[model samples]
Target chain A: MRGNRIRGHGLAGYIVLSVFAVPTLFPIYVMLNMAGKDLFQYTLRPLLPTFPYHFENYLYAWQFLARSFFNNLVIIGVSTTIVLLLASMTAYALARHSFPGKRFVFYAILCVLAIPATVIMVPQFMLVVQLGVVNTLFAVMLPYAAHQSLVIIVLYTSFSQLNESMFEAARIDGAGHLRIFTTIVIPLSKPILAAMAIFEVWWLWNDYAWPSLVLSSARLRTVALQLVTFVDGMAIPQPGQEMAANVIAALPIVLLFLFSMKTFISGITSGAVKL
Target chain B: MMDKPQVLAGHRSARRMRDVRIYLLMLPSLVLISLFFYYPAVSGFIYSFTRVTTRGAVWAGLANYQRLLADTRLIASFGNLAQIVVFNVIVVATMPLMAAVLMFRMRNPRAQYAFRLMYVFPMVVPMVVMIIIWRWIYSLDGGLNILLSLVGLESITRAWLGDRQLVLYAIMFVNFPWMGGLNFLIYLSGLQSISEELFDAAIVDGVGPVSRFFLIELPLIRDQIRLLVLLTVIFWLQRFELPLILTDGGPGWASMVPGLRMYHSISRDFNIGYGSAIGTVLFILVFGMTMLQMRLGRRRAAADNR
Candidate 1:
């Protein structure tokens, strides 16, 4: 009877796990199938991948949305670069030094992490309008970077894990704080930095609301916003090619996820750092 | 005495220089974050009390807050949002924990690795695409209803997004396969970090797998559970993306939440002050929830230590 129960439990485990697997895998198949077919084939063979593949769907999808992909790339690049440079600087200072107001700055940033973007967005939007950066990429990237003090805090924990003696020895050798930060701190934290880089890049690529609020011009929309605009009928008459735009919008993130899977997972698991 | 005083003075100056440089290094981030994050966050509180116009913000006192309290649409949206939060918290909190356990239980290393690969692949798909694909799935003549007709279950099939009664629940349960994505991975990491010796000791004491998990694993992984719960509440507090993408907060506000309402209010009516007022109230609620959980966790830790 004990042996029989053991066998039953083993079988139950597999069944339960397979059930979880279906939702994730099924959508992927559906998305690929949806992207592969035209409207007629989509109607008839919605679940099946039938060819001559309708590659022209991409052309239709891109007819009005191509500019958005470029704009998204620019925003992602600018935001990620600014976030990395500034976050590393703030993190380095917080990790290695003692100064007046250091505790205050750190605690303020901790509070900032909990402040939802939806809440402060109204005033943030006003500030952008006041700065005369409304309808500008700088508006999007500035908030994107400033709001990344959470990333700084995350990076701070990693920076704290660096070897103390190396930094002090460099300091003893008359190396300035800038040199020690650049030479010792940056090199030692490459793995975490790389992981944060991948995450911020992927994140900025998908950031929709901030851009939607800040960038009003049709010409300045990101790929994610473009898909929304297209589907909602504000952009253009893109006939029956949403799956194509959806596929394109999802592709870069998917490719990046596959490439940097290890670092991405590590970054999050690291975020589970004890308190 | 003179030599010692000179040496100490020199050391103090060097220390001061390092401190100043540290401040300088942090300068750019401080300035940018102040202008962008802190200034606006503080401004949100101020703006909530004003009526913003092309003529700049004019003081409106408690007018915006008074309007917020009486707004029927906002109240109904909160009622709807409360249901989403409870349902989301229950599903996202428990489902992923169970999956993490199942993954943790596997004996075959290769199988464990393969299952992880399968689960992790979906994290890459942009949130926008996921919502869009789900929209198509829920379409009137889309994959779901079509498949239902083929199987002779057409009566249950209906337009998922359009019908007011079904729209909210439809949006909630639409994530097929219902995998809790990153939360699942986080729990797995939490489980993996638990010492193997604790489980071995339990086995030696004749504990069953289920008993071992409950008695040992669950208590050990409380940190992960707390983390996920906190994150879920914070994210859902300002929940807009789902309603925005799936239904546009539509069919007469069945699926509308406060954030989307705020977005619409500011967009359509240009009621910036009222919108800021709504945002301020939400920040207080979410902030309080997070702080409470954090305090509870700390107390538990203290108790454990004692």
Candidate 2:
């Protein structure tokens, strides 16, 4: 009797959850369904898939977005590396030591959270212009690397939570700060560091506002900038091709999630919670 | 004995050297942040008080601030923002919290896990792609209209994004159900953190699902609710991406937002001073809200201790 009651509750829960899932997953369904359709098929059946899927939409999208894909790779690669190196080294120092001016250093980075990027965007653009890097990839890369405050805060908490006795043992065996950081700290903190890396890549990959301001040059445009202008750049402006490009743009993060699902989910949850 | 004092001084010097190395480790981050963050923040404030043109910046006193007072487009933008913020903070945010509580109470662990994965999978898609799909959905001859006509609601089907009265709500409706992102994960984790004993005790008392949620889960996740609401407010306050990309604040400035206006000032009009003033006002509002949240958190913390 008790088991039956519990089963009844489960059924209700399943029904409610499925109702919510429909709208959430609807767009993904639409994207896939329409991605292979021609204009004629799309008009005839806008809500469902038609016969004879046109796989060439993927081919055309790949050709259209090939260069922008490479550009995103280079920019995200360089910037994510810069953020990880700078933030981890700094986080290590702050977490392991208790030196003078420590509080000042911590607050200086923490306080950046209060100042939204939207506020300083204009002057930051002027600064880029003043430095004579207006049309260069550095215009986006430098600012993105500077977005290290959240990573630093997250790493600091994880680093401080490490077993202090392990560090002491390393020091006694003649391991210096750099050696300890590389061998002991880095290895143990892989999950957290991976999480932070994924977070950085996710945001930088998806960011359009800052890149749109600086990267007007066609060759330097990030995937996001290219995706927004994807239809415009095409010769014929096929709806199928546009949806195909959306799928292509979304592929990298999806692959990353599939491989590291645990880390990816935990990263987003904790990172935003800390903010 | 004299050599012991000398050795102590040597140890102190080595410690001092390590501290200096710590400073060196921090130098790259400090330099980059100063160049990109601190320097522009200070300059953005200074520019708000001046008139900036192609030639140079000049002192304009309170002129920019005064112009902000009379700018009707700016006022309308804020009005639109208020509607967006209210809908998101109150209505949109609740669904995730409710879903999370139901999942937390479930008897089947495997079913719970599957539902969680389904919600989180869409997050892998770049937000821009989602927005593009939504833009297409709201187009005149789009899927929404097609579906409406199929169901015999053809009279109500029209251009969702192009209509002034419905444009803002359409933008809000992009992620209908709003259960696909960080908010859901945050709430689920908050629910997970609650003690198991409280749930068991509620079950023993034969409390219904509704009563258990109201008395136990809702009050326990107060912190998460507060955080998500503040995040939603701050996000809606500054984000013009939807309007900027979807409509470009168009159909005759129906969806114009301050952030989009600021972008236009710099990119299109070259009116840097006015943009900076808008930025300053937004900064004050964001900073003030953040401070209010901190104060409330402290007060609640103190009361809990008492």
Candidate 3:
């Protein structure tokens, strides 16, 4: 009787999960299938394979998008590194030290979180233009780095929950503030930091609107911006090629999620609850 | 006596030096926020009060706000956003709550893990890529149409995004998959935190599963629900990528929301002041909703504590 009950539950779970999973993943599968087919085959049947496989379309998309994969890497790499360093240091000070106006500063950061990026995009663009950094990687990286103080505030809140005695002990061992932060506070807060890093990486990698406004040069276009090329002049690229580009664009994040699913889930939940 | 006074002066200097170092540590983030965040936000507000031309901004005092009030297109854009916000509240609130309850009922460990992971997969993919993939699915002879045909519903398959009436709702449906992830996880966490002893007590009172959910679980998860609703409203108002890529506010601006409308006014028309006014309205709407949500969340949290 118990065995039967267990089997029934398992079956129900599988059915429910698959129903949800198919919609989530179906687009990627369709894209892959479409990208592999030629234009003639794609438009003729619309469903079902007429060809084995071909990758020539990816090359065309790569050139059309213009420095896409490389540009995206530079943007992500530079922005993520800057965000991590600045957020960590700021978070360390806020979490560990007590200063006048600290509460005011923290609340200010929280306020910015509620203001959508769209609200600031126009003025931010004008600011970037006046600085003569338009169409450059710096325009993308600077705003992203500046906008990341919220990550620091969130991290600091979690880090503050740690015992202060640990810091005192480090100080007793002749460690200075910088030494204590790097050796003690940072290592102990790894879980929260990891969570913040992955979350921000995903955010920066997939961001579209800011990049669209600040970056118009073909050579500096990020992957998300490059995906826009598929609909050039309102002519949709072959379904297969469009799908292929999406698959490539989505691949890194998917892999990251699969590997760190636990942290990603926990991090988001923790952050939300704290807020 | 001279040596002791000198030592006391040295201690005072060291303390001042430490305080300065702390301020230096905070300097970068403070400056960055002032320059990049608060500066633009304040200037954005100021620009809304002017007339921006090819040369520069000229004082237009209330003209931009007047234009926003009189503009039919902007009004329609807000109406469209209201529809999305309504739909988002329903989808984001109810669907995930149901999924979370079902997830709680399942006893098998591996099944639970798999279900949780599957739900969150959509959250990992960038919104841009997700929209692109959906565009393919919504193509006339694409996956969705093919599926409709296979199910003997060929007449139902129109260009999902092409029809003026159906375009907004179709775009909403594309965002539906994301509903499963964050909301489900939050609800799950809330459920797990409820004490098992309370469930046992309810069972002893002869309460069934449905009543237990209503009498026990609903009250417990009220805070999470309120937060989720607030988040839904903000996200719906701010949503730009999906509509931008999918419909591009097509079929005579039928699907245009405030975000897209603001983008269009600036990028297409270069009417910066007008665009800033629209943006200001959007900011106010979002800010008001957030404040309302925070107030409700706080009240519920207080009540729950009591």
Judged by lDDT against the true structure, how good is candidate 1?
0.79
Better of 2 and 3 by lDDT: 2
**Model 1, residue B142: C-alpha shift (Å):** 1.6
- Candidate lDDT values, in order: 0.79, 0.84, 0.76
lDDT of 1 by residue, B1-306 (tens): 001122465877756666687788788888987888778779999999999998999999999999999999999999988888888888776888888888777766687778888887777778888788888788887778878888999998988899899999987886755564688898888888777777667766877877866898789888778877777777788768888888989888888999988887667788899999998988899778778776776787798699
TM-score of chain A of each: 0.88, 0.94, 0.86
Which candidate tops DockQ? 2
* Model 2 agreement with the true structure over B1-306: per-residue lDDT tens digits: 001122465776776677789899999998998888899899998998999877779999989989999998898988888888899998545888877766766667788888888888778889889888988999998879888988999999999988988888888787888876678888888888777777677777887767777888789888879888888887777777888788888888888888888888888888888999999888888777776666666787798699
Best by TM-score: 2
DockQ of all predictions against the true structure, Cα-based: 0.47, 0.54, 0.44
Q: Write the per-residue lDDT of candidate 3 for residues A74-116, one digit (tens) a residue.
A: 8778877777777778787777777778788787877776666
* Model 2 alpha-carbon miss at residue B101, Å: 1.8
Can you give the lDDT of residue B48 in candidate 2?
Answer: 89
Q: How far is A32's C-alpha from truth in model 1 (Å)?
A: 0.5
> DockQ: which is higher, 2 or 3?
2
Ranking by DockQ: 2, 1, 3
What CAPRI class is candidate 3?
acceptable
- Give lDDT tens digits, candidate 2, residues A1-275: 11122223666778888899998899999999889988788877877879899999899888878999998888899999999999999999899888789999999998887778777888998899888888788898989999898899889999999998888777777677899999988999999999999988888888888889988798888888888898657676689889999999999999999899999988877666544
